[model samples]
Target: MTATSVARGATTEAAARIMARADELGAISSRADALERTHLTPEHRVAADLVGAWMREAGLTVHEDAAGNVCGRIEGLRPGLPAVLLGSHIDTVPDAGRYDGPLGVLLAIEVARGVRAGALPFALEVVAFSDEEGTRFASALSGSRALAGSWVEDWWSFADADGVTLADAFTAYGLDPGRVADAARRPGSVLAYLEAHIEQGPHLEDADLPLAVVSSIAGARRFALTVTGHAGHAGGTPYERRRDALVGAAELVLEVERVGRSSGVVATVGQLQAFPGGVNVVPGRVELSLDLRAEDDASRDAAWDRIRTAAERIAAARSLRFDAAETYRADAVACAPWLQDAVRTGAQGAGVADPPVLWSRAGHDAMVVAGLAPVGMLFVRNGNGGVSHSPDEIVTEADVAVALDAFAATVAQLARRLEPGDTSTAATDEDRAPEAGA
Candidate 1:
């Protein structure tokens, strides 16, 4: 076989293996009809075990941390040198796509497989964080926060939909809640973190690009709002006498979209409910969820203020009561410039001389890890108009092939930068850890 054809065949074979593995992991879901794996559940354990097996085959020492993060490591020049970490979460949202988390993880294992012992200046570690979606518990990034030494004690009291507290769930899953602190990595121990993930948006697909370098992860805040009004018989409630909560909430939802667009942020009301459902009675109370995200925290907070002001107006005009409580918040995280250069170099080696850069609106484990180490990300183009978190999420084998090659190249580029006496971007204060909440 000619050199070009042989190279093409190898890429195809590697890509096929990654695709096959994604299929296998996708089948181990908690739901019968769709994919639904959550933190510290039976399915999580099964998936972690399978991933650990793959890590072993890749020639790494593997273990499960106290927080239930599956980890594998191969030493570099020496046993205890500070290491470069590569990984993504394995948790999933309800009805999630297989590629969202699993693809990054499987690719990490593949990259490690290609790295021989003592190959770089720093050791290489791959972690499959146990939770990033917050699907089972009220809190997200449990595994990564633990790794970053940012574990919040309050999260232990957080519970799942079935009323199982995180502490109890840990016990049930064969982990000690107190020992979870051991999962934290000491500062200066991790050189940097790298992740490869699907874009989860249409940016790359619109540009017709197979890959891009991530600029930053957007800050996000979530809220639960309640609107209240008087309920009355449908026939008895005259148009002029009506105080409909649903109507008021519908208006507020439109206001959310309007303010979000004007402020250049993404606001979504994914869930809305009306109480006292009856054909003869009007809805008296409504509850809805608001997810707000922006490239910066200040912008996100400002957008929320505008949204709140709009809600107040709608409630007053409709003669209803509106109240909102912040449910969760995470500050935005910017990727390190040096790491971004490495990612770009990697993509350029994979054929794109000028890869596009995008800010991630979706959260990832890297967001939490940023608190501990310099972080960077590579985004693979998600097909079907970049649809994600659904069964329709699609990624072609060709894209995966390019992603693997680019990801491996990224590791190599970082290695070169880390070589002795290379001060161009060599671990400076610019790469200082972001705040824990970052």
Candidate 2:
């Protein structure tokens, strides 16, 4: 298939709207020279203000919540009805690309603007979560977690690179850190969360499709691992006698890859360090960071189990000591089947029937929101082989057009499906239902 079908076929004024809005928001970064907005910063407040204004322009009542989330809402036909939440984060990683999180927020606003002409059964809420990148803190998804009623007071102590505590930053932002719990939404108040983001992977571009549906967002487990062994002179220590921690760690890294391949999970050893100042000296110790992810918790936990066993064996054979400390664990979440079908129907309605489906490996605010509401995502193909979280990240106008059209249709379709008062309760315990959820 040629790019002509999507790249040329999809050209709506809405694409131009999205493009212009993205550039405008992209310019509101923390750094004058680069995009680096983080949670509770001055730049973040500016971005939130801009998003709030756009939300109001989209015909919704807008405000910033206690946890600093930007929100705009168009109420349903009747009072006390559950809402359909459409959104993504507004924060960015350091020197990050403009599109990663903000595109979803902007597209969501555009979709709401498109459908404001009609009445829907469920309230439509557009949220620009304040902190998804965790750039200024250790815990990720702080905004969404607060919305999900999972806020932890301990996070207030989370310090940024500058040693400023989250509470201190919140105070600086004119928010009472103690009132952050007000950000949490009661369970069942939301029908679903729909996010439209760049694919951030190569599949959609490889298939020459402008848009795709997300199947599930991967659950991730992060660990800091250390391998300790005796230090000795590299030249004097015989290969048979040396107990090299770095060598043992290297072998375990391969084990991580091997288990991940066989288990169908994604395991990464992104950070590694070796001890000893001299290159000629044998490494005394080594530390590594392991990130393991899977679409289901069972598989992810299983992979971790096998990896632990392998690490133990490697250490035993090499006369090294092994230790691991888990730093983070976010459970996997699958889109509701009905919502998945809704996105597909929206794509089909937009003339891209049977588009490919992709699963997100990277974490997002959706992971936390999924605990409170069913979630669905629309993935627009990215240009330049899906490079993301960098200055190189990009999207084509044609793809944006397709995404805007499909996302708008998705709202209308979901309204029809949910009009019968059968709102949001289908997957209340999706976290535990691996087969059905995944």
Candidate 3:
């Protein structure tokens, strides 16, 4: 059936089922007071089982990959074909909301169940990637990276907070450490991948749109910066005589905010600590964490240059030694034009013409999967100012219903294109920004 003729994707049944599934998954967490599930843990395994059952019911052949990724697939006309993949992660950070990663996985299953009747040209694969939150090993996207053949040996040696090694965790989880490579999906076997997740921001809610296409995932860089000076008695040291490291750090923090505001980038100093911090002493040293993100790679890097320069100048003038080191860097990823068009077409087919598009500031399994194939994403509006990664995160079922319908339409639209080997014309990134709701 054509996308235009397809009914609302799996309806409220799908939405309700997703909510129920999320609750079950949420219950299998590490903490009684909050949701805290980590990779390669019992909670993760149970979640895999729970999602696997839904995949099976959707008429897809399901299994847990060697890397512990819960995967389900519906075959194409033949036994093998380049598959269209859909999904998000099942793992969560400490006290995470149910909607962030879980919602995407559930919505993908809903799409799969709704589209199985059409039996399109390409096979469909739904994956509940085992790890996207790096709570267990301090390495995010572990599951998707394995699937992308981007697994690094360094991660094996990675340890958790309690000094549990990843290799040890694998063995404890009854998974073979030697077989994680088996999860790597070959490059040519995937046509595209799509993920439906919470917007994780207030843009969609502010604009009163329930669904939006994701144009790109922002690139991010993290740093640990230290400013060192001399400590002195607060009562003895005059303001001009005191070389305070904390004061320098405070100035740099303000600079970061100003740059972020004027540059339209997101830069945060989430952590700040002062050595020799006392009510009666000038601080000797200050350490801070810098998290910077931008919609594009050039802008992100360029902004970093500006920030670093400003920090150096500020520290030099304050006579405080400044040292900064990058702890992590991930490049931005743009959604494939063909996939973006499919999402647009899907939204239109679902009765939303020119639906708003959004750029995700947060990372997801989609970023890692982009290494495997072309990627697209649909964002569901979030509640409570779109605050995610916490228990306060929430979603309205009506928005979810709308998101599922659009996601299903996206599946159908892509299926139609796959049948004919058609690639839609590429559009400018201006289409990626959120516009006033129509």
Alpha-carbon TM-score of each model against the true structure: 0.93, 0.92, 0.94
**Sort by TM-score, best first: what order?**
3, 1, 2
Q: Which sequence of candidate numbers ranks them by lDDT, best first?
A: 1, 3, 2
User: How far does residue 403 in candidate 2 sit from its true spot (Å)?
Assistant: 0.7
Error of 1 at 233 (Å): 2.7
Winner by TM-score = 3
lDDT of each: 0.88, 0.83, 0.83
lDDT of 1 by residue, 1-438 (tens): 111211222277788999999999999999999999999889998999999999999899999999999999999877898999999988899999999989999989888887878767789999999988888886778888999998889988988888999999999999999899999999889999999999999999999999999989999999999999988899988989999999999999999999898998999999999888787888999999999999889999999999999899988998999999998788899898889998998888888778999999998888888888899999999988899999888988989989888888888887877775666654678775465362
Comparing 2 with 3 on TM-score, the higher-scoring candidate is: 3
Better of 1 and 3 by lDDT: 1
Write candidate 3's Cα lDDT for 1-438 as tens digits: 356433455577778887888888888898999999899888888888889999999878999998999999888756687788999998999988988899999988887786543367778899999889988898788888889888877888999888999999999998999999998988578778899999889998898877788889988899999999999999999999889999999999999999999998999999999988788889999999999988988988888899999989997899889999999888888887778888888777666777887889998887877776778998888989999999888888777777888888888776666654455422234322221000
The 10 consecutive residues of candidate 3 with the worst lDDT sum are 429-438
Extract clashing residue pairs from model 2.
Answer: none
For residue 412, model 3's alpha carbon misses the true position, in angstroms, by: 0.7
For this target, which candidate reaches the highest lDDT against the unseen true structure? 1
